[model samples]
Target: MCNFKLSSSPSSLLVSTTKNHFLISPQPSSSSSMDPQPHDDGLHRWPTPQEALEEIKAIGKISGPTAITGLLMYSRAMISMLFLGYLGELELAGGSLSIGFANITGYSVISGLAMGMEPICGQAYGSKQMRLLGLTLQRTVLLLLSTSVPISFIWLNMKRILLWFGQDQEIAAAAHTFILFSVPDLFFLSLLHPLRIYLRAQGITFPLALCSAGSLLLHVPLNFLLVGYFRLGISGVAMAMVWTNLNLCLLLCLFIYFSGVYRDSWVGPTSDCLGGWSSLLALAIPSCISVCLEWWWYELMIMLCGVLVNPRATIASMGILIQTTSLVYVFPSALSSGVSTRVGNELGAGRPARARKSMIVSLFCAAGLGVAAMLFATAMRHRWGRFFTGDEEILRLTAVALPIAGACELGNCPQTTGCGVLRGSARPRIGANINLGSFYLVGMPVAVVLGFGLQMGFAGLWLGLLAAQASCTVFMLRALTTTDWTLQAERAKQLTAATNNQSSPPYPPFDKQSKAAAAAKVASETFCSGDTARDGCSIEMEPFIIIVKN
Candidate 1:
């Protein structure tokens, strides 16, 4: 029989056995076990060095699809702009203004909602909790649907709002018509956001890129035929928008169903996965508010600018510049999505060091893309104006603004990528607050003061806006640079584990028979010397023997 001894010292205990080796770990007291244990709070918490490098590489690979999606989406937007320009100044203004409004209302809201899914789904995916992933998607879809009704109402009543802006009857009428055609598309658009988020969380991004590419192909021809040949004007543009959104939604749905992800045993709804409706609402509301506030600030700026100058040419020029800047924003926007998904996943997997490394890689990549875009914008600055209109005065004025436009790209890339990093961490409120303070509290007032009070016109207003964005970029970069990845990883792990229980075991420990069988075939053996004629006796043993003496 093995002999076991109790030691006076509580911390150290030893057991002596004749055969097998044994390990002893001191069990904590009941009170100690019940109490919280101190956790590692270092700068990074990747379990191993190899894991850190693997995460960075994985995140880097995932960004390709995101970048492609951004490019496709940008192409669609540009094509729409091109179509609007072909229709004449009044139609261009009307189309541009209406598109701007719908985008702020619909696209921005969808984008925000999509962000809500990243942290939740990314964590779930990282933890390998497939069921929780499906439930999160379902919950997001339900919440987004609920939010859509209020937005639809807002879209329907947009004309009344435009009337308050002092828009002429013609512009107001065109805006109303465009809105009517566009509002119904929100339902389809809502589905698209959640679907994109779901695929992205799984590190599957090519589907969105492919869908966007397909939609753009169909969108261009439809816009041309409806607006150019059919003379549908603003209505044609609205129709094209609807068709594109519908196509995107359908394609995404089909891909999700066919990918077999839905049918996979690891994925789908579970008892604990559904959670309370309130949990989803809690996340969604803040996310929505954050996005709405940011978009609304820009809309407010545009409306205020419209009323500040006479002949409305000033507003039109500003709209042109906004559209131009938005086109270049696609690169950073894609990079941001890539960062959020990758960072959230790594954090959820309890790899803080990897998350930090991925963030750095994303920022560097985004900055490189930003530099290339700036160069392109600068080189093509003079030629770009002719694409929008034949007006010499508009072209001349736009040319003057090119350098500043290029400068804005520098700030835009970092700010957007920063937002993505924050969103992946489920910290949209921070981004929202930063945008509000920077744009409204500082940027807007400065622009208004320069444009009207100082009588410096549109250039002054843009200059002030640029300064505000630059400030925002600085603040965001600082926040990203100084983020505590260890804390982020812990939070990510808790959230992911809560949502999906990926850490839970599917089977319990082995039974007694299995344990005995495992032990019997590998018996302990020893060689000993006792008494022999010429040499020590050779001993054969079934179990290995270990001798200890004190």
Candidate 2:
């Protein structure tokens, strides 16, 4: 057995440099898998304040484009509410309710599962395990498409389900009409979302921003032509978005496959893609839970509003409030994605201190964005709703809800960023538990009590949101404070370097078959010297080197 260390503290392969060629065997990290052995070189220790600031600057470089991408995504989600609200109170209320339902049953699950790809791809890219990114993408695409089949049934029967949930019959009918044209949205998202994680992990975000902005710019005119002139009603609204998303997806694929920007990440579909089903599912299920719990809860608040007295006014108010908060939320969420990628990449490279510094910087960024959003909401509370509707009651109710939503952001932003830290660190189970406890165990009961028992209506539901966000923030902070960054870095190393939960020897014996021999031949390859900072380091028999990421 050969003892191979993963950290780049040494410049060359662990084996004797003088040897021309040799078969190398590597073992699992250690018997105590959860504890990382501390090194005295200071590479993995806590950072100084200046170092933290520098790390933040690096994270912001990536997050700037990421933030723009998120803003565009928010704009896409807002089309229904913004356009439909202008149609009539009935359309706004009905459209908002249906969109909320679609999110819960369809988009949330798909998006959550896509998050599993974050750690996988981020770690893969960081460690130079370029092949795994393709496998992760293929496996995720398979899972999402399979999952979408059952979710399609829910969208089909949405009208009846809303009626069973005690929604007003007219609102339910209008909601049904909107959902009827939304089926394609589910299928398109299943593909596009996983691709997002793959690209973000490789730090390829600007194209995403460009693609989304172009789609958004085209959508406005399409909305006008279809809904404004053709008078296609809600179906027109649904078609406008559906076609736009489809075009965006196609453009991204063409850019990736043809533009050479992502050439190394994707190698056409392979046999290995079909083999990692169970391993991928292990991370994916928890990731789905972690993200879906938070996303569904936010959407659930809108649904809860529909059952209250003066349902139209309350639902419309919640609609404006939900879209407004979502638009504001794009900032923190974008930072979260950036940090997840940065932390995972550093950890995969076995740089614990960098990952730790990334987390601290993200928390501070979230804090700053939260303050700006709160002030903006406070200033615009009376007028922002004018963009969505002319009704004074809806505008007033929306205004009443803005302050609370803004306050909620103060806590919500940090927790959201913290969740990203968890994802990048391959610790989604912790996030899932925190979300389950905060949103369902504590916050749901509080919401019901305030909303129904006390007749607080929209205000009561927001108070519940605040409670949940606060609880989540406290729990996530506690988790972050206790995290062993060294251990997380070690885990990242293991994930990117290991195969099937075990480290693969550099020269695993190959069968005599032509395919196996060809694979081994390809494996014995190299690029630039195995420098820690350069991505060229990879598996090779000539000056054989291996690197890992978190």
Candidate 3:
């Protein structure tokens, strides 16, 4: 007679017997047939059709709210710019420059960090490692906070940076003042980012939407009171930003507390799990550089526009184009979030096939939307530029730029969606590198030569940008299409198992009896490096051999 001992760890189950075949008896209500034992470890377990359908529904539910929130936030910011323009050209130019600086320094960094959280949280949630999910959230917060110090110092020196870019004295002074009032926002914004990401990871996006709407509602009236009525000018815009962020931070914190998501077990300092300050920096530094590189490229383009004839009008018109395009981008951006969560969750759950399917669906949806936006922008080209300005010359120039802008939307969908897919797979470096190559190596130089060297003006400049975006889209699509889901699934499974072992003790060590049971469990789970090699489970030893053995 053979005996079996059940182990405590969910990853490994032990059964002792002389027989070669193990029977996996289903529960009384389960309809599964009694046959060869299936995998007992969690990695190889697949979601039921019902579960997949639920996930898809959840993705759909959040998309609309996400889009609306993005639209509202951006619209409020645009309204601020419009109001500032009414004061004077100097005020308008200064406000635009300062806001650009603040966005690149504050919002861009927060958004990038928030992007990193999606994959980590989604994976942890899907793998059923709830404690690790909490740990990841804590670590991300610590990481963002620690980095805020250096970012603050950089903001303190904003005058010098703008001077280097050849901004006149008055412009530099306005930018410096705004930086002084706004630099501290980096920390506040950083705090808000993790909270937003926390809600997003749980598939609860409506709260963020509501909070954004609340901020928008408050920002406009406050802007009118400060800049228009009080004559605080640029300083008023700065104050509005500060108060709005504070409001958002407070609201989100309350939401987290009230939702009971931050109980004693989940919420606390991460000093212990952080492993040390170096670990946090290791994740954040690369991400910071990545975002800076992308934003700086656009900043460079804007600077180049300033060197052209009618610098003020050139910059202003381009600003309108940028903001308008950004508004349209809300759709693709929302879809990207959906893709990130879906792909990350599926990958974490060891369902690479499902992850692949989700990516395709997301890509198709994004492409269809992109086409629709292109048609809409083209049809409205004559009237579209009037929304930002009424100057006949500016409007005329913008009309010519519209078709190119509309065409640029075609590339937006694939590139943004591909970025989301890569982030979900915990491979942001790949997307970052692609952007660097496409924008800097290929796109910028073309725009410079055509716009300035050839004197093609704004038309030439946009053509250059369009080329870059198209190239990026092509490369990203190829990358997405070529992903090897089977390999990804194996890697994900190994990573999850290793994380599990580290967090808790293994049920049995590699003794004769334990090895036999471990081998059986691994086999049933299809735990092999290669997709083939049926019936024999092979545990990867490269990354976690020591940890697994220990």
Q: What stretches of model 3 exceed 4 Å from their correct place?
A: 1-56, 228-231, 276-289, 493-550
Clash number for model 3? Answer: 0
Best by TM-score: 2
* Model 1 misplaced stretches (Cα beyond 4 Å): 1-57, 82-90, 224-233, 265-274, 307-311, 498-550
lDDT string, candidate 2, 343-417, tens digits: 887777666766777888788888888888889988899999998789998988888888888888888889888
The superposed Cα distance between candidate 1 and the true structure at residue 547, in angstroms, equals 49
Q: Give the TM-score of candidate 1.
A: 0.76
Looking at candidate 3, what is the lDDT of residue 441? 81
Mind giving the per-residue lDDT tens digits that candidate 1 earns over 19-66? Answer: 121212111111211112223432443224454444345554456666
lDDT of candidate 1? Answer: 0.63
Give the top-scoring candidate (lDDT): 2
Evaluate all candidate structures by whole-model CA lDDT and list the values in order.
0.63, 0.71, 0.64
Worst 10 residues of 2 by lDDT: 1-10
Where is the poorest 10-residue window by lDDT in model 3? 1-10
Candidates arranged by TM-score, highest first: 2, 3, 1
Tell me the TM-score of each prediction against the true structure: 0.76, 0.79, 0.79
**Residue 109 of model 2, lDDT score:** 87
Model 3: pairs clashing at backbone N, Cα or C within 3 Å:
none
Candidate 3 lDDT (Cα, 0 to 1): 0.64
